[model samples]
Target: MSQEIQNISPIKQRILQFIAELGRSKREFYSLTGISRGTLESKTGITEDTLTKLFTAFPDLSPIWVFTGKGEKLQSQQNETSPLFTVNENIEDKLLNIIAQKDSEIKALAEEIGKLKQEIIQLKELLLK
Candidate 1:
């Protein structure tokens, strides 16, 4: 509710503040939303094509909320059984695979470090003789 935003139309204000919060340039918003310049221009009452370009460029927004503000701030829906929840299953599996691999690596490294420490201790004992 800053003074600058208070004066503008609500839709344009939401778009502008959302962009600023996302910490990205307008060009990035254009790429993210895939929204046409004309579409954005018609909705926000912003005459500058560059203004509309902001929506498409930013990645973190839910296009639904950005376009109509009718849903959650993010793209997630309310229904617990929505298919969208499973949309990233493959990506999640890949991440778990990577984490498992890293865990194995860490276990091996810890074992090696233990062996090295024992060797150091034996060497120190020899020196003490």
Candidate 2:
């Protein structure tokens, strides 16, 4: 209910919210939903194509809620199943992924710095008589 979420169309907001709930990468969402990265960004409401793709990927989700802003967000589960991923697990997984990427970036930067330092030493030696 922040200003940003309130500004966009309701359906788009729900889709984005669902994406965060899924704890999956945008790349994965695009692959599964068959919608491109900017599809939600540009669209205000659900289209037939988007609805079909969304439902196909997420059968548990409530299309009525996503499309019309009516009813529960999820389809009622007769079997009383757990969510696809626990909220804590989703957050933990995202944090871990971020840490891994940052670690890799730091390593690459360290290697580059070492190379630059060595080049500086070599240049200094060459300039010294």
Which candidate should be chosen as best, given TM-score against the real structure? 2
lDDT of 2: 0.80
For 52-76, candidate 1 gives per-residue lDDT tens digits of 4543454445666755777765554
- The top-ranked prediction according to lDDT is 2
TM-score of each: 0.34, 0.50
- Each prediction's number of clashing residue pairs: 11, 0
Model 2 regions more than 4 Å off: 1-4, 78-129
Candidate models: Cα lDDT each: 0.64, 0.80
lDDT by residue for model 2 (1-129), tens: 477667678888888888998898777898888886777776366578887898899998987788787777888733446543446667778777778879999999999999999999999999996
